[model samples]
Target: MHAITIPEPGGPEALVWAEVPDPVLAEGEVLVEVAASAVNRADLLQRQGYYDPPRGASPYPGLECSGRIAALGPGVAGWSVGDEVCALLSGGGYAEKVAVPAGQLLPLPEGVDAVTAAGLPEVACTVWSNVFMIAHLRPGDTLLVHGGASGIGTMAIQLAKAAGARVAVTAGSAEKLERCRELGADILINYHEQDFVQELRRATDGAGADVILDIIGAKYLDRNVKALAVNGRLAIIGLQGGIKGELNLNALLSKRGAVTATSLRARPEAEKASIVAAVREHVWPLVAAGRVRPVVDRTVPMRDAAEAHRAMEAGGHVGKILLVP
Candidate 1:
């Protein structure tokens, strides 16, 4: 087997595709022959030595992939060898083959092919867990998403709108904002030129956002609190803006707001299974009905993962980038 390995964390150049030993299947796990995997911001961080894969996880950098089952491990049932599936992985999606927990596997949504399905798992689970499950965003509420052109941002916009919420997004460029609009975002703010807090308040008649999905963690924390409506929920899933920031407890108390931060890669298997189950039940239907779709910017060959990482860091893509093996 061959996988992307980082002998020394540095840059995109550090992602070296090389031969490695095949993964041994543990009980309740399955071996998947990777068709494709999606690049994520976390992958970049891992390459730079800022983020490490959880204990016992694959050293590779990918968190989601689409592939066919090659074999099933002990105690695995209901799924069979040769099943076409997409899975939420803890790590190792960059490889030609990966071992996945049975609970993390999902049947490819109807009408979606293997290559594109590679882009779905991480964004779907991240957005669904943060926006719908944790924040409990409901119909008629206004939800705001930062980095609106990103994989998670694009997914969040469509899912919130599909659930009957008014969706708002902050992107860095006009082109990205236009794409967000095409995905059902009701309000689009060019963060490079405008204040999202002001723009969102004006868009909602000064009512503010009922829920905010944020990736720019510490840098946006104070402003995010200011942008929230009373009793609002803010879910932080990434810390691209740095990890340390001060919180104004008085402001939060006055608004009765809540802030939560989580990482899908670090979650326990049972918790991930629960989230995956909910996504299959709730999100797959929307996808199958053509209400939501995977937004892929482009696909790069697996051997050129370094190029994919460069593209992500350039911040020019409007959606997910797939690495096909």
Candidate 2:
């Protein structure tokens, strides 16, 4: 099998596609013949030597993929060889074939193709688990998502809207915000010029957002707390803006706000299975109903994953950038 490997982490140029040994399936895992994979910020961090794959995970950078099942490992059931599936992976999506835990697999949605489905798993599970399951965003609630034009942000906008929540997004430009608006975003703040905290508060008549899906971590922590409505929930999923910041406990206390931070890659397999199951039950039907869909910026060949990484770093894409194998 051929896969993207990093001989030495540096930049996008570090992603090297070369022949590698095929992955041997572990118990409760399956072999997936890769069709497509998606670029993510984590992939960029991995390529730059800032993030390493979890212990025992694949060395490759990709975290999600869509492919057909080639074979299953012991203890795996309810799926078969030749099944068309998209899966959440700990690593190794940027490859010809990958070994995936059966519990992380999701059947392709009714109207989505293999390439497009490649972008769904990570964003779907990330948003659903944080916004719905943990934060308990309800109908009439408002969700403010940073990096609104991103894969996770785009998915968060749609899912929040589908659940009858008002969606607000912070993007770098008007065009990207327009794209987010088309996806049901109600309040748009151009972070380059506007203050999201003030804008969000104004949009909600000073009530602020009921939930915030934050990707910019510490750089936005103070404002994220300020942007919250009473009892609001802030789910932090990325640290693109650096890792440490002082939190205003008094401000958080005044609002009775709660904060949670999580990463899917290092979670236990059983926890991932639970999230996948919840997504299949709650989100798959939304796709089938045409109420939710993937937002892909473009597709690049698997060998040219470096190009995809460049696009993500450029921060101009409106959604997921895919890599076809």
The residue-by-residue lDDT of candidate 1 on 153-267, one tens digit each, is: 9999999989999999999999999999999999989998999999988988888999999999999999999999999999999898989999999988988999999999999
- Per residue, candidate 2 scores C-alpha lDDT tens digits across 268-323 of 99999999999999999999899999999999999999999988888889899999
TM-score of each: 0.99, 0.99
RMSD of each: 0.6, 0.7
Candidate 2, superposed: residue stretches over 4 Å from native: none
lDDT of 2 at 70: 98
- Show where candidate 1 strays beyond 4 Å: none
lDDT of each: 0.95, 0.95
lDDT of 1 at 265: 94
